[model samples]
Target: MFTARRLSMVAAITAFALMAGCASQNPYDPNTQAPAEGGVSKTAKYGALGALAGAVAGAAIDHNNRGKGALIGAAAVGAAAAGYGYYADKQEAELRRQMEGTGVQVERQGDDIKLIMPGNITFATDSANIAPSFYTPLNNLANSFKQFNQNSIEIIGYTDSTGSRQHNMDLSQRRAQSVATYLTSQGVDGGRVSTRGMGPDQPVASNGTADGRAQNRRVEVNLRALPGAQGATSTVQ
Candidate 1:
């Protein structure tokens, strides 16, 4: 949950940032670079890269069994969040169809799937509570995940470059935990789910524009393969 004092401060910072109209860049992405190519949002690219980086970091910490998603650490960086190429193509197709026009993007990265939920649809400014708009799409995804129990999910939360680093990071962390809690309540196994807060480190859009900031503040769920997914969907369309 977001505290009132923190929210007030973040809201103040956000209001000022919006009025100024320039996005600040943390240590990861500099303000100078343009939007990423292939029309892929920097959020997804950076997230995937972050997930990969996380994997490497985890592997460093636990060299014996790096395949575990929990070992990715709290940061959840890197593209190799987990080994890919296990989910079925038809399942991905179904997920794509379900997410169509829902403002929830379904992106297939090799054997993994990334469902990107932008802030406008997930949460209001400076808050971590799940918004009503988030339910419909998540319910739809939850249904799919219930059937695909063999898959492990990594939920990463991000924010725009409006507030202080610590505040933004804390907000992002709470948001991720909220989403994870809701999903578990919806029947997605809590054990297979991991949450990480990337803060304003991975912006999909420029923090400069209101629309860009809206897109940058998001939660991305990456579905990865599990080794013993006996009845799991593994076909690629």
Candidate 2:
């Protein structure tokens, strides 16, 4: 009787161990650390961690091939970040090339890029309508944006201090909308574009001199990649 009881207790313990093993076999939690294959930076590391977490969650929700799914998701996220960094660098270089001597200032703040255009190119005096000559440059820009399909474009118009504040504001808003419309017509996704007018509120140059007025009466185009489309690269212009 004693030996039989001992044997029964051993069997119970074995069964419990097996059950625990099966219960703990979580495919999504591979505990696999991302290997530093290359010179990965802190930004890349954080991005990878976030991607891994997202992948694990997604795989768990799917309830199918969770381990494989998580791995693939993490890898994709890492690759995308690396690709975006490379693409952004290339784009900055290309922008410098195209904007050289154009008198337009290009600035990148965080993920946003700004292109400032002189008013003479965008509109005629006191007119909200964009100039015919301006279409070429704008078209070229639109073409460049086609490659970066996931980015949004914002057009902002401004005017000199020649007109009433209200009038200038209205004209500027119209001008901005016009540019947005033109970009949409040029094959840019309308959903990814917006427009606004600053009137004379934001002036990069003085409104006193002819040249300064010309500069003040201008438009600005801001570009930023939409969420989930980061690291994707395109050659539009």
Candidate 3:
């Protein structure tokens, strides 16, 4: 009788362990391979945590009321963050495709892509206006960028040391604005574009030789998806 009772208890314990294992299944385990859609897995995790925290906080604040409102708010915040992350991923992919095959060098810096352009394709010497021949290329770029729904573009103009500091600064600002205008005209949303002139502040090459100066007098186009822009706390290094 004693042996039979011990066996029954052991069997019950084993069943309970199996049930617990089944109940605790983690859907978002990283070891489980993700789907081919390239979704933002991290965002989903963050969103779940955010929602849980929100619900708890909400419930704590309103002890008289049930935790329903808190749970809803938390879920909303999580969903919003996840949605933004997905949008950012899509924009990044589209930008990569559009800039590919073009002569421009595209570098992925965090959540933004930087297009480094030499002076030859962007502007003429001591000129703030873009050359007429560059219109087609610029237009193509703008059109390609239109695929991104929530991204911002920044045009940064630079110059060599051939002129006064103030003069260089002014020229650089105008040049940056010119590029921004061209982009806006080519279907890119005007509100999503910004311009800055670095003058001789950030040079890619030495300013001692003609070639280096030419390289220095260039424009850089920086494109960042909205989520990245929002999360970015510091200037580009």
Rank the models by lDDT, top first: 1, 2, 3
Displacement of residue 93 (Cα, Å) in model 3 is 2.5
Which residues of candidate 2, in runs, are more than 4 Å off? 1-78, 231-237
Backbone atom clashes (below 3 Å) for every candidate: 19, 4, 0
TM-score of each: 0.61, 0.63, 0.60
> Residue-wise lDDT of candidate 2 within 1-237, one digit each (tens)?
224543344334334433432342221112321223243322344445545554555455545555555545555554454444434444544565566555666765545568888977778999977787687777767776776665678888999999799999999999999888888888988898988989998787888899999999999988876777576533433
For all candidates in order, the CA lDDT equals 0.66, 0.65, 0.63
Cα RMSD for predicted model 2: 13.6
Q: How accurate is candidate 1 locally (lDDT)?
A: 0.66
lDDT by residue (tens digit), candidate 3, 46-101: 44555555555554565565345454556555455444444444454554555555
TM-score-best of 1 and 2? 2
Q: Where is the poorest 10-residue window by lDDT in model 3?
A: 24-33
TM-score, ranked from best to worst:
2, 1, 3
**Model 2 lDDT vs. the true structure?**
0.65
Cα-based lDDT at residue 156, candidate 2: 88
Which tens-of-lDDT digit does each residue in 1-237 have in candidate 1?
334653344344334332222232111122322323353333334434444445445544664554442234313432222112223334565777778778998766655668899999999999998999998888998888887666789999999999899999999999999999988999988899999999999688899999999998999999876766532323332
Give candidate 1 misplaced runs (Cα > 4 Å): 1-86, 230-237
